[model samples]
Target: MEQGLALLLALSLGLLQPGHGQPLHVEPPEPEVAMAVGASLQFTCSLACAGGAARVRWRGLDIGLGAVLSEAGSSVLSVHNASLSATGTRVCEGSCGDRRFQRTVKLLVYAFPDQLAVSPATLVPGRNQEVACTAHSVSPTDTLSFSLLLGNRELEGVQALGREEKEEDLQETEDLLFRVTQRWLLPPLGTPAPPTLHCQATMRLPGLELSHRRALPVLHSQTSLERPDPTSSEPPTTTSPQATPQQGSTGTPRTDSSTRTCRPEIHWSLEPVSWELLCEAACGPGMTVHWTLAPGGLAAYKRREAGAQAWLSLPPDGSRTEGFFQCRLDPGGQVVSLYVPIQKVIPKT
Candidate 1:
């Protein structure tokens, strides 16, 4: 009992402080932190006791491209745009009252694209057009997968484009960036079909699952053509073989030059209180725009502009909602959609 009382007295007298090899009570107490490339990173190291004023310094940040701010009893290390090369161990040292302490943090970094890029959002019926989808940069290739979907059918996307690398991005890291791509020959669009194509990217982090999806409008392009007979006046064209594609089986569908030129784009903006997602798709004269959620639920408040452009306005809760905000255009056959994925992350220790 006397020994316990003596220890209490020592603590009350401020005679004890963090010693060498001990932690300095860092703000982000997690043993490690995982951040996306170009993300903002900040952490603090602090020490306080009766052993004079505390001073802290950070080590192992030469490649981090960050700055350190030291205060009376604390120090903060902040990196505005974290580089992939900066991922590694970071150390913080604190000293006070002739006593010194140290702590270490592990930083994990990843590269994931914001959008699931799809090519040829719209297409003419009858042409065997090659469709492709791509994700720009990805690291830790084994943890990521891409699925190309047509209606309910799913196909795996290949890393056909291979790796796009830089000398400085990896330095001595085991994970490197890669460009994933896949292509397919558009199949014949049977009548009354939902011929939509989707490119979905899925990433499995330590304890988080991230997904991004983009869809293409119905672009069926398979048809047969035959010369019209001028010799017989009694409807010679009706005797030809019936066309079965969306453009009809009798002949090739006439395609508009404007439809081929129109591009699909999604402009996303996040503000303090609310966020917006705008889709600029080319819907020609026969197509119309529709908005819905992928899992079959009420979508965010939306408005369509100029018959081809659509906007989705989320609630003013200042929190990002997770799911796919879809914008689609068709003549009402339930086809072609562009997905805007809003992610919500609950970091795991």
Candidate 2:
């Protein structure tokens, strides 16, 4: 009877020990978790035992950040407004009967910028000015960069002035606020249209990156025009008449005095031209030459490179030429020539 009581007591003592026959299991068996800044993360710890109900509590081991713990049925730890400093180890403890259980998990957080902004929304034209851009609420501030864009073109020579960091106290936690500023000198504007400016902010890490962009309000400026000089005197020129031979019955020029003088003007230009020297090619990735003269007449076309001596004759079909071209028209023994230089097309990166 004594041996039987001892055996029963030993068995009861073993049963009273927590996790004696059952183990503690934590969800997300992987020990580490990664989360983005300003995001939320949750960790659940559960206990399974042949014994009775267990008491559970969650705690952070490596960091002092506060997390929400739910212990009604299962223990859960929830972290909000995660930041780079929030990375650490978390522990969950459970007690059942006279035994204790614990589990550990690791956390990792990534930092990124929140937004981009431009100061002095409107930029004035034709004035030497400076424009400022800011990257707001960025983490890992040293990795943040700012760029400026006018219309769709990226502005060159933009410089980063400086950066500052401030400590912000939130309702639940404290955060580091980083602001980066960049400046660019605005060129004089000659167009009446308002220029659009874009501020771009980028944050880069080993394997993570974030970007944000914001556009400034339309720029306004006063355009100055040159006034005419009233002290200058010049004579206005008059157009002369051109002689047109009277047509006979057979549509031939008559040699009589009835012939009259008629004036006809000739001008030359490219079909499509712009102030810029750059032009799109007519063929595959090459430069094309085009020259045309107004008032269709007997004309000839020739082309040659700037350094080349020989000029190549072009067919009258108005086909694309490879180099600089010139069109000549002979009317009344007066010859007129129009030259057009072909600009090479540059490939964009």
Candidate 3:
């Protein structure tokens, strides 16, 4: 009983001493901080104590380790080339007399996607073309979106692929890369005015939203041809064809000046004509009618003989045929036209 009373008296005396037992309060850095990769950051720990000497220290929650950043009354932690491994909760501890106190703050490090790009700088009109857009070096892969647009209109049936994750072992971080593709079937002449293609990328995250856009111009060629009048009464002049060597003839074949020439007439008509008979009469030896497109113009052709069951479709590679030719072209949506013409060449008399 005497020993127990002596211990109680000693504790009371210690408590009565001035500034022997004081409360310590610590204030950590901001509640949260965000920084990009390869950047620098600093965290501060503030302390308040009623008595006794006060000391401050910092520790990482993820690593469960403490390190001395500053030795004065306050503590400061500095990080360089901040990366994913540096992100987490950090604790600041302060001690005064026999009392200890701590506070915690969170750090977040992220990277935004790089700029967007378009493939095939130039786009040709009236052809099936593909445009590809790409973005690189993005973080937090899931918060990204990509799209293609023309002016304010969003293109339909576009193909998009992304989120190819890359790991960096040294930085202990992950990055993402993405791409989007669009297939366009341009009209023969495109729009009345040139169109612009736009590529966009968006990143959505808490407390932050980022977006980027890139534009490309579409180019096209235009052409027009004037049709000749067929009702004139004047006869065309005759020019002799180049003569080939004959077995018994010593001199080249010659044409008489009085011989009259019949020229092939071209016109745009709405009604279909007999192609087989027209071709047979117009395309004889040394006398033929040729078909061609105007400068900078593109067209597709379909043909039907006098007695054919179906119209034969011709490839886009400029083909020549003597027949009733039906040419079609598209300049833009809701605009299309067909030209049907027969070339008639008169045989040499």
Candidate 4:
């Protein structure tokens, strides 16, 4: 009986011995709750097993747009563009022989921000314009904080416009509206203009960090100056003409046409057969006007004065509508003119 007892103890000890310097495998970490829209979730799993070969498998069940970000010695599962329906069980399984480990993360997907846009107000120097920055998402209020970012500078805006709130009627049945706005002022126009303005919104939810940004080109008007003190009796000591400043360069002349040729533009309507507006597009110093057309969505196409080509094209919809038309000037009249509103109706259903 003593020998039998001793043998049993030896077998138990051998079986319980440490894994002899073998690598330790681990299950991936999973989120505790649901993920919000516009947020991302990543699951990491690793295999540290002794010897020749071990494998790790990661999968997210029923989550659309789910991806295997990495699959090697370690594995990662990531989900982007998540929606409410994206929530489900995520599983990470690691296996080596009879040794196995697994982890499960329950995911609940919430609504993401819907509309994102910049205010259409004209930004003037030293004037303030409220940029309407907002996000419509069903995620918990406390889980996300919208932010404004430009380059290395982070602006919550001049002042917090505060989140939009809706009030329900006593009957609890009525339409609801919510909006958030922030004000930003353009710096005084000068040489070497300031950087373009942009707004960004960031969504911080458990297991996810997602952000979106949009840029607005800073527009400024140039002021013209008369040749300094023309009335001065001074023979006008010869002064070199200042170099023409390029776009985004600080305070420079708006129009520099010293050597450029001035082409008389012909703006006429072909459908109505009448001249609506006469405008000239400066073509380099010697370049002449070649062709002009009422670009897409323009109501009428007009031929230029100097027998230049004239044509008109319909917008996406086949409706004869009157609206702004783009005029392409020439060598590559690269700088296209603004939309010229034309007066003509092709017809609409």
Candidate 5:
């Protein structure tokens, strides 16, 4: 009778409990996610088990980020408009028989990028081209600024504005969404034809728990003005390595701890067979002007290194037929560069 009871108990337990050795599986295929602000993001939790009905649960739905859709054997967490508040790890769980499983999907929200786009692929000297930079689909237009530079000199009056600034019939939301456009008119370039025109867009986000990412968002774009070959410098060539200027007075006064600018006085005297070009940068005597030939190699420096005043004799023969003479000054190891034309050398006929 006892043996019969034990057999009956065993049968009952078998009928009540699920089959052993099959574990519940819960996972998200791609847990790491990045989405633009106001975009849609969704993830479904995977669940597997044997011999029992599977069920699922979505967590973090109460955070006001989005809604969760529960289906047969799986559940999906979705953010229809992913904002900064939606950037975090979203959790989902599932159960099969007595087994439970958990999975998390991380999401990130971003704005103020893609990249900075600048129009007019190349800039030419003496041409007043309107240069425009766009911070595509950025949020929070206020406090965002752009800076425009032509060969390291900041051009003024670049204003950062978004669609909301011009569209009078736009609705306001928690975060304003629009493309930022900043424009600056390229001045008649007097420095060099091949000026490095650089544009940068910078935006500061609020310091919050937006995925623990507090770093600022910035975008950059640049194009060089194709410099025409100097009437004296050679053909297209590689740029010379930047020479470390010394602290002594070399050409001009210090513009700052880092830069020095000079308006060099250039003239040439007559030699028998060749004309001698003389350029003076008055940082005082004992100052060696760091002469450089830009957009080409220094074999064009005329190898004629001099003090305060530097001279490069011209036959236009064994040397360059055309190139710009960049007069550089060093004060505190900062080299300021300015290109001068041979027009300064009025050879009196």
Candidate 6:
């Protein structure tokens, strides 16, 4: 009777713990993640213990739109041309014999740039100069904007030059062009030194960020001071001719600095052959004046190399012609006279 009672107690224990008699299975699916902006992505799920009749189920945490790639024993997902919204986690569940097993993985998406550029690289100072930002292979679906960065201030007035989109069989590319003309009044010639101008082009794409830049330099014309008569020894006091008289002994003192005479001297012949025979006052005695042939085939002074004396050489083309010639005078190393124009000199009749 005691043995019978013990056997009844053992059967009661087996009925109370049904799973303890067999192996327990738990399925936790591994999560898969990938980037979406520029490339494709894939997810893989692994299984632990396998049951003869086990089944796998796949799902996403926050992914808005996606289809299940495979739902058999194992899970595999492929995403083409992914985007930022595809970031999140995935879960897989396996079920068999009234037991549930699951696995999870985190997903991360990357954003691909549609346009790129540098900071302001060009500055335009004048009213007509142009500033430009150049970008290559930008996304055509995105809008591009451009502006100027002056110190800490942002300026607008830029114009889009052009846009282009092309697909090369497998991939597509785009370009953007922006330009602006300087219209503000340029500072006076003596205004504080102008600053460098800078420009930027920005692309407005939903999932991308990029920009380009250019800097240009400002420029202006400079005012020049009037020069005194070269023939007169004294520097010009003013631009007026009355201030520097061309007559009278004191009209314009011929300083001993230059070889030029304040008064006009005898008009020397300007003919090529005459120049060869006449002696130039500016050249050293015995120095040869080398004549250079210009494209017009005219005999001209190439340069006056310091030598014993100045001499003239006829052009090789025999096209040595005459119009006007400038001559100066020098006494030793000091200039005794200034340059003066000699009119035409033809062959003597």
Better of 4 and 6 by TM-score: 4
Better of 2 and 3 by lDDT: 2
Stretches of model 6 off by over 4 angstroms after superposition:
1-40, 43-76, 79-124, 156-194, 217-349
* Top TM-score prediction, candidate number: 1
Rank order (by lDDT, best first): 1, 5, 2, 3, 4, 6
TM-score against native, each model: 0.43, 0.37, 0.42, 0.37, 0.34, 0.29
lDDT per residue, candidate 4, 70-131, as tens digits? 45557777777665556677766665655555666677665445445454212234544444
Which wins on TM-score, candidate 1 or candidate 3?
1
Which segments of candidate 3 are over 4 A away from where they belong? 1-30, 61-68, 95-100, 113-115, 120-131, 149-194, 220-349
Expressed as tens digits, the lDDT of each residue in 1-349 for candidate 5 is 9998976675565432323332323343555666777788667765666776778767874345448777768777777877766667776666766555566666656665444555433344554556556665565566467767543556554343323233223355455456666666655555434425466566644332121111111111111112222221122222223222222223333333344444344444443444454556565555666555442345643546656666665424433322234454444222323232222232223
Supply every candidate's count of residue pairs whose N, Cα or C atoms clash at under 3 angstroms: 7, 5, 0, 13, 6, 46
Candidate 5, which segments miss by more than 4 Å at Cα? 1-28, 62-66, 113-171, 176-349
* lDDT winner between candidates 4 and 5: 5
Find the 10 residues in a row with the least total lDDT in model 5: 211-220
> What would the per-residue lDDT of candidate 6 be over residues 165-193, giving only the tens digit for each residue?
33323243222222222222222222353
- Candidate 5 global lDDT: 0.49
Cand. 4 TM to true fold: 0.37
Predicted structure 4: clash tally: 13
Instruction: Tell me the lDDT of candidate 3.
Output: 0.45
> Which residue pairs show collisions in model 1?
125-221, 126-221, 126-222, 217-336, 243-249, 243-250, 244-249
lDDT at 251, model 5: 37
